[model samples]
Target chain A: MSPVHLEAVCKLYRGRQQLSWRRLLRPQPPDPPHIALQDISINLPKGNVLGIVGRNGAGKSTLLKIVAGTLAPTSGLVQVAQPVAAILELGSGFHPELTGWDNALLGLALLGLDAGASQQALSDIADFAQLGSAMERPIKTYSTGMVVRLAFAVTTCLHPEVLILDEALSVGDGAFARRSFERIMQFRRDGATILFCSHSLYHIEALADRVIWLDGGRIVADGAPQHVLRDYQHFLDQAPETQTPALPQAGLARGHAALEQHRIPARLRRIRVNGQPAGQAVELTCLQSTLRIEVDFTSDPSLPAPGVGFIITTPDGRSITSTSTIADGIVIGRDVHGSGTVILEFPDLPLLRGLYVLAVYLLSEDGLLVYEELPQAAELQVHSPGPELGYVLLPRRWLPLGNGHAAPDCKPSAHRYIRT
Target chain B: MRGVLLLLRRLIRAYGQGFYQPWQLALRHRHLLRQLLGRDAIIQTAGTHLGRLWLLLGPGLQILAWWFVFDAVLRVRPMARFSFLDYFLPSVLPWLLVQETLSRCLSLLREVRSLYERSIFPLAILPLLPLLLVWMIYTPLEAAVVAILHGPQAALAATGFMVVLAWLLLPWCYIFSLLGIFFPDGAYGMRFLLTLLFYFTPILYAPQMLPENLQDILAWNPMATLLQQLHGLIGLAALDLHHAWYPLACSLLVTGPAWVLFRRMSIQIREAL
Candidate 1:
């Protein structure tokens, strides 16, 4: 049986309303609930390591808390076959006034160990905590690392069947962090299930067999670690900078059309490639790979084979390349109207690792006037891991300049691609 | 009738399991309970200059203050057949024990909310541990004091009364613990009510000091019954078995609802925290 199962879990947090005398005297409708998780279902079998990755406020922590049984979902069924031990937050409940020894014993008790079992486990916990005589000193006297050590030791020593961790390993120095990972690995070997949530993709990549990516309180993607991580990386690549255009006050109606112009065209919506939602950024694993861009749009019925054009430019507005259907001499034989989609295929595409802006234009069939021009429609990010750095990869070869020694053993070599 | 029978079966199963499972866990994990209690005791006394002696000194001072206020300042009569010190000491000690247990159990779920956030365990015993800790510290010392003042028989009887007092206080403590989690002002309300309860109880003065009608109503107070029974046990008042059995029955009856409330609120407490 699966060690953990969550079905149709939804958590709604009611906002705390400000209490007033009048409000107290008269009953008022409660504040609307904030949707923390919506229709989340998961099943984690024993020994499976599930990594949760998401931007802040993505409900990763909420999901972990639900599994840990600290927070009950508003509506759902949760079943866990074995006892759960969690380190949901670092230094979560460790009392500052209590000594390390006392805190460990208390933690053990809270974890369901009786006094004698906690005492028996105390020595192992001490050895793991490595606080030495400092174990007797209050936790407030210990450093942050010491506190983490004590928490980690007490939690891991219990050998819980299902462990849920929420960014708990982010602290601690190098060696200690590695040792903690080793301990988690040992738990994995012992067939214990783990739910690990972290912002660190490297840890998730190294540790998780499966990954779930959450966005806006919903699981947007869930699958193999590499696939989900790649998709998330693509989202991050196109994510807007910290500075966003501030909205004007309601009273300031003037110049609102200028802001309206900044918004992407409603007619041309949704971009994807190879069955993956590309959004404003597309991720490619190889430098020279087939690049397909599918654009779903509402077309004007009167326009017959209206031309489409796109321009690629550097982040600072230097145009690198531009293409147009009119220039390419590709004829759209039939007139299209209403909802239509255009597929732009670029085989063996060449691009460099850097942020590039993509601007798209819709033109009249004659290509004389611009029907719609969207500037900086998307930001294209090309990132391929390698030591080589340049604007594009080229098929250049060295022939020993002056034909020295006849370029011994000149033969085609097997190509290797970097897998990062 | 079938539905009622099913409901009854369910209630019995739920309440029975709730009651038995915690004690079963407590027995199995007696070490954990002991360690937790020991930690509380250590933290209480470790930093103070008085140290472990504060276990007695703290309550001893309170007893002395009561003795001074009533016996010396007020020049109060015993009202019972025995002396004021003999009558009040045995009864007042247990009274204070129950009072502290209830008050301490109040806001206990919130105090341990952060701990529960970290791990899962049989949470029903949270209020029980503090009571046990208080009992572990004061009962033996107070029992010895009773032996010195009275005799071995009285001490044994006092010990038995202490056990009974713990049993009587358990369900109420659990009830208030859940209340403290749900209501932010519950602890303060409980404190105010307990102060009122302390006065209504026949702690400072004997039941004979009250008017005849008032004594009859006060007889219904469980604390008063327990105190009167304790006084009986120690030879300070009349030994009537009804006083003991009636209150025990009432307390036991209250446990059914308290246990149901506990089971219901257990889920909510996690949410509230």
Candidate 2:
């Protein structure tokens, strides 16, 4: 049996309303619950390292919390292996007044250790925390790094059969962070099933065998870490400087978009490539005529106009290059009717012989919450006549062997097709 | 013992098996529970000059105050066969435990909300916390005090009574702990009510001092029955099993609803926090 398994799990949270005489008399309907997770299902076998990645309010932490058994799902079946230990946050739940030694004892005990095991784990924790004599002192006096060290040592020492971590790798800096990471790697080597949720794609790629990407309480992508991270990284690349906090947080600790169901932020209405009517998968020639793509969208009229973003990637979702109105600080103009049209022109399309997918996204005015995604909406098929190689044709020319002068037709000029 | 076990089993089985969850948490994390209880004591006395001695000193000081008021200032004596000190000493200690436990329940969940936020803190065992702590600290101490005043037999009987009292207070513990989350003002309301109950209990003074009608009212108070049984154990009053009916019935009535309410509102309590 899989160490971690979930079927159609969901968690819903509703904002609390204050009691008032008016509310008592008027009896207004309660606001709709915020969707943390909806019909999320997973079956992670033992020794499988799973990573969770998503934007703020994406319910990655919610899914982790559900699996960790901290938060009960509003609905669905969840079967996880026994003796699950979790490090959901740094310096989580330690009393400031307690000594480091005492805190470790408590932490290990909280992780389901009995008295003898907790006492035995103390030496291991002492070695790992490296607090030395300072371990006898109260935790409040210790530096942030010291607290994190102690917490990490206590959590990892038990070698829990099924360990779950939420951004715990973002431990304190310098040699200790590397040590902590190495310890996680050691756990992986020991065949422990780990469910790691982090915003650091690098860590996810380095550690996770599988990855799940969540958005608006739903799984947008789930597969190999590389593939899922590519999709998630693409979303982040589109709107890198959104107003909403991009920092990942533990489940239910970060603020959620309450009553998100009631709002219609933005939606893609129409798309046209090079003035040709678009199909579900529009195949267009590259390195020939100029490529003009038009996107028509609608937004909530009362709110700020949403941003438009598009990405060109290999068929497997490794992003080649992407552009966004938000990233360029361009304010999309929308009419009072909430309809807006933006046209992107790629002159002298220089993409070489390759099949590329174009994805369109409608971002919220703040450029964080993705309103709609048309993934692989358009496919570009390029077959160049010249004997050039690579995914992109550089704007350059080869000089003749007998002379230093370049051919007149192949002269280098300041153009948009500069290779990186 | 067999009869008691049968009733306990019936109670657990009656509560829809959710009763077992708290038991499981308590058993699985018993070490954590012990550590947390120790931590609570450490936090109370950590910075203090006297340190762990303050556990007894704090109570000793309160007992001194009560002694000064009732014994010296008011010059109150028991209306029954025993002296005021004999009756007051045994009963007042348990009342103090009740007062502290019920009052402490007010902010119990809130105090640990941050802890539960980032970890899967087993909260079902929380209400049991105050009870267990009180039991750990005072059960032996109170029994010792009873032994010094009475004899070994009375001390043994008082110890059993204290144990039963701890078990019986579970419903009250859970009720107040949850009320502390959903209705914070209930703490203050309970405080005032407990003060009223303290006067009515017959712990401070004997029941014979009150009017016939007020004495009848004291029959419903569990603390009164506890003192009566304790007094009986010391050979100061008649030992009758029939008087035990009200307190047991009261526990059953309170526990049935308290456990159900906790099981139902356990999730909501976390949200409220």
Model 1 chain B poorest 10 in a row by lDDT? B14-23
TM-score of 2: 0.72
Best by DockQ: 2
TM-score of chain A of each: 0.59, 0.59
In the range A1-420, model 1's lDDT, one tens digit per residue, is 699899999988876544445567897887787899999889987899999998889999889888987777889899986678787766666777788888887787767776667789999988876778999888989988889888888878878799888886433543355457668777888988999898767568867889999988899999999999999877865766332212211221112242244321123444555455533565554355566766555444443556677776776545567787887887544334344567787665566677766666655454534445566555667665555565555555555657474444422221434443
**Model 1 C-alpha lDDT per residue in residues B155-253, reported as the tens digit of each score:** 999998888777777778777887677664656788898898898888788887899989888877878887877878887777887767778787676
i-RMS of candidate 2: 2.2
Clashing pairs in 1: A114-B29, A114-B31, A114-B32, A115-B31, A115-B32, A116-B31
Fraction of the true interface contacts (Cα pairs closer than 8 Å across chains) found in each model? 0.53, 0.67
All DockQ scores:
0.32, 0.43
Provide the overall lDDT of each model, using Cα atoms, as 2-decimal numbers. 0.72, 0.76
Best by lDDT: 2
* Chain B TM-score of every predicted model: 0.91, 0.89
Candidate 1: residue A309 lDDT (0-100): 74
Clashing pairs in 2: none
